[model samples]
Target chain A: RMDQGEKKLSSVDRTPLHTEYVKSKLNLEGKDEVRKLKLFMKYIGVYGADARISGFSGYICELLIINMGDFHRTIEAFAAMRGKLVIGDPENTESFDSPAIVIDPTDKTRNAAAAISVENLSRMKLCSRLYLNGKMPEYVQSNGQRKDAKDRGTNLRVFRIKKPDIMDDILYPQVMRFKNAIWEIMERNDLRPVSWEVCVKDHIDVIIESENKAVPALKIHQGPPVDEPSSLDFYNKWINMKISRGPYILGDRIYVDLIRQQKSIGDVVREGLKKVNIGKNIDDQKEAMEIFDPYDTGKDSCALDLFLSKFIFRAHPPEKTSRNTRSS
Target chain B: RMDQGEKKLSSVDRTPLHTEYVKSKLNLEGKDEVRKLKLFMKYIGVYGADARISGFSGYICELLIINMGDFHRTIEAFAAMRGKLVIGDPENTESFDSPAIVIDPTDKTRNAAAAISVENLSRMKLCSRLYLNGKMPEYVQSNGQRKDAKDRGTNLRVFRIKKPDIMDDILYPQVMRFKNAIWEIMERNDLRPVSWEVCVKDHIDVIIESENKAVPALKIHQGPPVDEPSSLDFYNKWINMKISRGPYILGDRIYVDLIRQQKSIGDVVREGLKKVNIGKNIDDQKEAMEIFDPYDTGKDSCALDLFLSKFIFRAHPPEKTSRNTRSS
Candidate 1:
């Protein structure tokens, strides 16, 4: 029996405790059936609550199977999910708001599927529908067989950062935070980051794909309207300044063309990283971070594979692969 | 004397009739002062109701002087004018909506300031305020002394089209219509047009200044969201199509990067002109249009001067001339 007035357990601590509670609740016949479904979720890459995976956890899959009866019914239930997916009793599930909600049977206050991101939930539904349609092998078999980085028509920048001596749960979220900060830096500099991915192995590898490698040297700075009181201040500020063009009126607004200090994506990222908060742990080891154009550096095979599978070939199925390769 | 129940006179025919009406209304003493102000208006390049000028006509200037007493008070009245300048009795002026409204003295139904564009009205007010502060010579003397096209940090495209055999009023609007069409073309193709001017001499000279001479070869084309029913259609469409990158999902929306057919501004303009309505008169003579980069062709001195003075030096006063030239 559990202590009545014990403090709430942390997610890491609660997992083992919840497994015991879930095992106690299930009968012998249902236990074997739920175990098979948990393994099935793992096989399809949706069996972790880790920040990197952001999919269904093993315990959540157990709860889903216990409630829905079997693997086929569970897949059918997910395929039919339109908006928010609610499991467990209606009263307990009402408080949780996420892409998928599975009220923890062991601890009613917590959501078992809290870690599932919208993309992952949508991917789960899509995969379930594909599985029902007999197209599962296209997704499962084509995991790491994506085309090379050079084959894709985009400029890729890869950063290899020294991974801090931290646990996987703690390290993964911080790496994701750093990735977001870098994405913002690229966008702020007008580099136009299209897609990005993070792979943590021996080191944290951040791969970003952008539309352009360099921005125009000249940047247009918009100012106040010509009739506004502040327009005089705008004129005074830029009139004597060393600008490329303008302090000229376009329509009603005053604008000046000023020279950008950092034109190349490499230079912009280097300068921008100094100001933005890229997580406390990562910031400490930022000096050890090395930037490379994918062409310059022989990228780690795993990092390249992760980028291609997650981003490049994500929307493509095997039937379309032949056509995509031909056009590309 | 005016005939009753006659058809409405054309602007050209009405000008002489209005001039006679104004002269008869004004006493001999007021006539000399009004005529002097009319000459002043002409000297400052604001004494025409022609489509090219879009400013107060001679008769309008005569009306202003007769109503406001003299040039100094007329300048004072304009300088103090705020939004929607009303120059006649409130009842008749109430019906006309323009930047400036002056109910015609002879024909109460007509707005005498109908031809004056918002820019010209604002220019007249700005000039008046400058004059009030003893800065008239800066505007009057700096007519044709602007710097060369090469010195300015912008890409200039000059088009010398064969001048159509039409009336000045008819031809000027058509030229302006063609200029607008070209501006739209440049904008649609992502060539940012900073400023443009049209000058009609022996040929119709259209000078356009854009941010870049050429756009990137690749262009991003956005499609419907990934969750929408049309996303499958987006996938089907781009899967077979030749594209640079994507049909990839960024955030929620699907996007594809396609190779631009015309990367150069000149090529874009050339192709775009074929599809647009650039006035019936000019369209007939479109084959005679010759494109040039101002550097390749020795630009007409008057056309170059007009581009600089009207666009470049229009915002700058004499005191800032040395500063502007130094920075450039």
Candidate 2:
């Protein structure tokens, strides 16, 4: 009944038989991991989380637990393996592009681990290594420490967004696109942030941390090479540039350092956001959006929590305020 | 007293005496046409209409009239020149890269036309050719008959910016930067405009005309090629892509038809503006910024006027709307 394509066809036809046979074989060897493997897979991720997410499947999780024993050893094996993780020696290895590849224990010809995502794999590795060392990193939406980004000398910009009415599979790409849009905006304005991350729950929170709350007054500009036809247009544009200094020639390229009017990161983001496609769902509730910083914005604890747990560690950065080193 | 470098040193040491001699010589030839030349230069631009604009200076303009004989003929000569216009050749042409090069009439060694900008040359050729052919374009800001842009089935977005309290020398570049920033925004949003123009006046108006008012529901997305390590990420991201079709492979490239959440151009701009550095002066009066279509926006004839004289010429586009034959 759950028909979509060839994958669904196989699942409907052979999945039940494979499940019964694999379980009985595991029972004979007293190697079935109903309790342990299920818990491990859940902790790492919802096995093959979405139909579109080609991460770890329950069958792969079961096979891994049987073969590698417990959670600790199974994850350790995955981490230690370099490059493509080819499991069974099948005759034809035409190759695949999934993050991790594992052969089916019951069906020698199939790849059981074809759906695992690289992002999920990266998460699993980071979490496993930390957990094994007796420390657990905060997962998304999990409450953790609350450190103000400003106190750490980092420029923090929190955008309170309304999550789109979409599932994680679709929402993941949309949110990623939104992040790219913000990142591009930040870079374009020369308020290039050192780091950024997104968190989604009841609502979406975008956290951007830059070295400076405001960029330097001067904007270093580049134009066409000395020879091109448009290089003259560049010269014309800059010679009549509306700034404090320059339209000066810097070697073969035209370079200028003009004063920027909107130097603050908050101001830039506030204004620049009106220029790009920020996804439709967020666009609908765009008016309801809230932008926050540490100094004056009526403090929200959720934003603070996200900054503390996700962005920074309690270990203080050497300096309280990062210098705008990019002012060259 | 003013000291910058070589250009200044030359201007101070030798330029004044040359200016005096040229005026006297032109007078002897019954051609002390300073008044005539000044008006012509201002009309054609490059007569210091903009502080930073390095076009034909008054001295260069005078030299041109004396050599080419009056306004009409001077423009004709400029229009006929091939690649790099070589004026009366100096003894040794070491070759400088400024737009039009002319051997200084006063000091045979110096290139008098070095200050002449390409933008001016381009304007000169365009205006001169058009004039000779019995026409004159509404250069920069001139009152001309207005025509509607929408009847042709094109997308026009207007941004009315409050002019910054800066001189033209400084203002020209800033507005250009603003235009470029908006262009990047439009492209990123997939509302890639076919043509974009900026008009600077008491208020700066940016006009962007795209073939699309709204994009298709799907976005034909591309990512890293297969066999590369990052290709796995491309696969993982799209395989579970939400609310769309495909993570299909075209040769070695990964492709997806993502359902665009924000399909409308207006919505994207409204939302995207919040994420960038919209410059200082613009940010201050950003709330006052208005975006609208033809029938809706309260009659500000200036915007409509620019769209007409500057963009459309009442000439039919033979094939109305260009369908996205690019759907290949």
The DockQ leader among the candidates is 1
What TM-score does each of the candidates earn? 0.74, 0.42
Off by over 4 Å in 2: A1-328, B1-18, B28-56, B69-73, B86-98, B102-120, B126-146, B263-267, B270-288, B301-303, B311-328
Pairs that collide, model 1: none
TM-score of 1: 0.74
Kindly list the per-residue Cα lDDT of model 2 for residues A146-209, writing each as its tens digit: 2234434446777777877787766766666767777777888766565555666566767776
lDDT of 1 by residue, A1-328 (tens): 1257977678778878877877776787677777776665655566678777787877887787778887888888876766666887887888777877888877887778888877667556655655676655434223334355554445888877898898877787889888898898888776778777777767788889886578655567888755564655675676557665545555445677666654777778777888876787788767667888766675442354445555323622212232234322
**Model 1 chain A worst lDDT window (10 residues):** A315-324
Tens digits of per-residue lDDT for model 1 on B1-328? Answer: 1347777767777777797888687888777877777665655566678777777877787888878988788888876666666878888888888877988887887888898877666556555655676655534223333355454446888877788788888898889988998899898776778777777767787889886677655577888755565655675677556665544555445577666654787778888888877787788666667788766665442344455555223522222233234323
Q: For model 1, what is the error of residue B273's alpha carbon versus the real structure, in angstroms, after optimal superposition?
A: 2.7
lDDT of 2 by residue, B92-114 (tens): 33455666777776666567777
